[model samples]
Target: MQPINKMKIQFDSKSANEAFARVVVSAFASQLDPTLEELAELKTAVSEAVTNSIIHGYEQMEGIIYMECRLFPESIEVIVRDEGVGIEDIEKARTPTYTSKPELERSGMGFSVMESFMDTLEIQSKVGKGTAIIMTKKFSQQKDRSFSSER
Candidate 1:
């Protein structure tokens, strides 16, 4: 299905930008008229993805983070990407409580949180290249009038 709407945003990989990214996505997703719980879930998922890119991907160094959101009739897809170090083992990274940087006291639950909050989570990474996280959520109550009749 074609996207009803789409938005792309690029920003520096800084911890401060994490909140900004979440808010931006929340606002963009507001058009869907999701319930408060759904909105909070999306915001939390976005926060996790952005934080992972800033901390794990860039390792607190300078880098760029790209995010794109696409709105479909009943679902929204979000992509968060970074240009920095990538995960060597995606499976290991997905494991609960598995952290590459133990010195930082990382919780290592970012991916888990994203997976729990979103309908689907996909990760693509290459060492020395970067990492990209794609997440999608289907709205149970769609606000788009164009598709309301189908319901």
Candidate 2:
């Protein structure tokens, strides 16, 4: 909540927009001197959230995706929001390998990956309304432990 720097950007909910989200998030966080691993995790998490918004939330149709990055002195928070068909079952959605569209090759790992990458991941969705994801990671002087694997 208390970030040293804050940034906000909005882009179309398209697959192409995913790259922008990742790049911008990484660039903004670069000011903190986060490790490459940390930056990658941030990018991956952002990609998942933005992809979900574009693929599921907006159903690939043209829509807007709002992303906010808050860089704290010892932590970071990224919020992604979409004004599209909201999630019906947030509990189930959070479950690993749970995808509303299984046929879409989606691993349903969006929420799972976000949870794994960040210290906190929260999702709020309402049917026919929209979905918002709030992800936060607190940095520690200790070695990076946000994930089990180095990659």
Best by lDDT: 1
TM-score against truth, every candidate: 0.92, 0.90
Candidate 1 Cα deviation (angstroms), residue 121: 0.6
lDDT of 2: 0.89
Give residue 53's lDDT in candidate 2 (0 to 100): 95
Candidate 2's residue-wise lDDT over 1-151, tens digit each?
A: 4567898999998798899899999999876667888889989999999999999999999999999999887788999999999998899989999898988888988888999998999898999999999998765546554552345
lDDT of 1 by residue, 72-95 (tens): 977899999998899999999999
Using alpha carbons, what is the TM-score of model 2? 0.90
Per-residue error for 1 in candidate 2, Å, reads 5.7
Question: How many residue pairs clash in each candidate at the backbone level?
Answer: 0, 1
lDDT of each: 0.92, 0.89
